[model samples]
Target: MTKGERAGADVAERAATGRAARDRLPIDGHGVFRPPADRADPVQIVFDQEADRLPDLLALRHRRMRASPLAFYRGAAAVMAADLAGQPDSGLRTQLCGDAHLFNFGLFASPERRLVFDLNDFDETCPGPFEWDLKRLLASVALAGRANGFGRRVRAGILSGAAQRYRTAMIRFAGEGELDVWYARADVDDLVTRLAKSRRRRVTRVGDKARARTTLQAYRKLTTVIDGRRRIVADPPLVVPVADLLPTVDRIALEDRIRTMLTGYRSTLAEDRRHLFDAFRFVDMARKVVGVGSVGTRCWIILLTARDDTDPLLLQVKEAGVSVLAGPDPVPDPDGEGHRVVAGQRLMQATGDIFLGWQRVPQLDGRTRDFYVRQLRDWKGSVAIDELTPRGLRTYAELCAWTLARAHARAGDRIAIAGYLGRRGRFDTALTEFAESYADQSERDHAAFRAATKS
Candidate 1:
């Protein structure tokens, strides 16, 4: 067998014997990421990140964050990354979502037109301990539950339920060959059918809403035909036309630059995909405000029309910066951030955006910024946590667990991780406790952030 095939064979043998001679880490130890008495100030970390983003949008980002502590935590992936530096790990690494909060899990269309549920965001994605993503996900559950005014016991139960499901799912995935695990997909319909009547109804509604978000709907809503020219409608802060953001002279030049970048982006696609992509003619481009954490970054929507004017496609190209997990101890990532985002995304997601590609654009100031491009809102949808009851949260948490385990298994040594997790409840219980305590810490940090920003 080839070396890689040999490695897989070795791992399969190890799993069959309960990871004989593998490093056996204690389950309880996953819970211990004790912040030094002098942990980094959360407010300062927020400002540090804000410094590199668009200036005017910082106010909007801060406003969104102040709405709730979970909102704050959603935008504070860097702060958590710094804190996770102190945590013990299984020594097994995977391409991390870096910000694997509950809100980041969503349903999106696969290339085959099937809707699949998986991790959605990848701006800060990079290689890190598998547990770091798990920890971040569990903590988000606690914070989100608290935001909905769920009781402490209810919130803790959500974390416990989620962790247990992750352990169970990992064990299941471990039993399969690596290639078999890689081919697995978490189809949204399969998920919906398995739920109770109440959740099934809710998920069905979500599917309906997602189905309605077609390219035609987007074009009709966001574009207008003026004379013979189709143009993106100016929508102020939310969806500003490129002309609104720059003078006429600069607008012409920037559009030219973007067109050139698109050429580079097209080259990044596979040969077969590039032939398909070439069929779409560029129509217009606009700056778009997107997401809680991604608020202040440079995000643009590119509209393309197929041979017929009625057929439309929307592509979103957003700036990619250094991953939050590119800390002192994590795997090094000094190359292209755009490639970093795309590689991690492809590694973790069962299926990915067909148009996904990366490019670096030169700025007016003689610098270049990395960016990754993908289809915009391809039947994309997320659960409304505030609308969910405590029981609904429990069900959703389990779904997140199943999805995350599949993602982690795709990138890391599934046999070793599953063996480290074992077929037990000890790790699950410890993680739930850790999540609850971390939620309390998040609230206090949120208060400090509010005060610091106010001052």
Candidate 2:
């Protein structure tokens, strides 16, 4: 057969695979959300994750999670993973963001210095049924809309519309050339141009804030000159220097161990990136409390400087644990969980951090842990979900959905998945129903969690 004929045959085979998936699980089957009779206690599950996290920061994590149902949902990816596991999937596999909440989508600088919108978190990312991500995203949309006081009808429209965007975007990708699909991205400037005048002002302000969040900005905000030496400012429970975290006798030893870990992490990067990393010398390190979900996890911000204190590079060393979506029997990963996060992030994002790397380190607590390292901040900013109007929220959710579809298309079988969704609103309707029901479940779980920790 000719090369053109072979390509045609491949497309047909993938389309057949997608259509056959419908037989295993019909489109409407997605609407159902019957909790298992022996479902795990969601509150207990949230506490269970605290076992490996920093004990000193557990209280702060609890406080953050207890803020609202939406906040609780953000930190309760494990709770939702259990529920998603109880359902039958469409068997369409993709590198899932696992925690694809609405807030996870944001503006960040691309390698070429242009701002782009895409999924930014991948702590729980792993390969799984594609709808698992869709479900996670849709539920967040419902929760966010409800939190913003949008009525049921408005929330429903947003949910369905978001799902519809994912479905239609996948269909379009299915017909595009491989290169076109792979190179597709959501440019923030283009997005602003597409919005109405009133909305443009809001989004442009967000874009400008993100642009100002460069490493230099972080340097000024997070550091101070103390006795002719630049040091990370201590903010107690939120940000504490390593020296404050340990006794003077142990500080030097801990610094030595961290330097060794950095060397190991550097080996994981490409030779060119390693050369770029070599220019910076370690200056100071600190433990920082970050995000609603990642609060208790071990997170360290390492300060590296080259060409004096003015040129500073901050790297975040965040713990990477077993993905909540990992199956009963996960494949052995020699490079460990940290590698899992870096691999998934590279696959899903159009532009990744130049310093992205991973390492396994033996901790002072007498346990070995995996950690992924990356630039602490690079023009990263998320729109205030609470500030968005109902229409704005809907638009943002749909943009997230489209961005997700592009990510999935780059990592999964776009043709097959599109074939499964077909050309209708059935999948969208079902997804909206499931999202509302799951949001209700999350609220109940949040109440239980609040009651358990009310003391």
What's the lDDT for all of these models? Answer: 0.84, 0.91
Please provide TM-scores, in order, for all candidate models, with all chains considered together.
0.94, 0.97
* Clash totals, every prediction: 0, 0
> Candidate 2 on 1-455: residue-level lDDT in tens?
22254366688888888899998889999995879899999998888878878888888989989999999999999999988988888998888999999989999988789999999999999988999999999999999998999999999888989999999999999999989998999999998898899999999999999999999999999999988899999998988999899998788888888899999999999999899899999999999988999988888999999999899999999989889888556675689899999999999997878889999988656788899999999999998999888899989999999999999998888888999999999999999999999999999999999999998
Worst 10 residues of 1 by lDDT: 16-25
Worst 10 contiguous positions by lDDT, candidate 2: 1-10
Measured with C-alpha atoms, the lDDT of residue 85 in candidate 1 is 77
Residue 367 lDDT in candidate 2: 87
Return the lDDT, model 2, position 267: 96
Report the number of backbone clashes for model 2: 0
RMSD of each: 2.4, 2.4
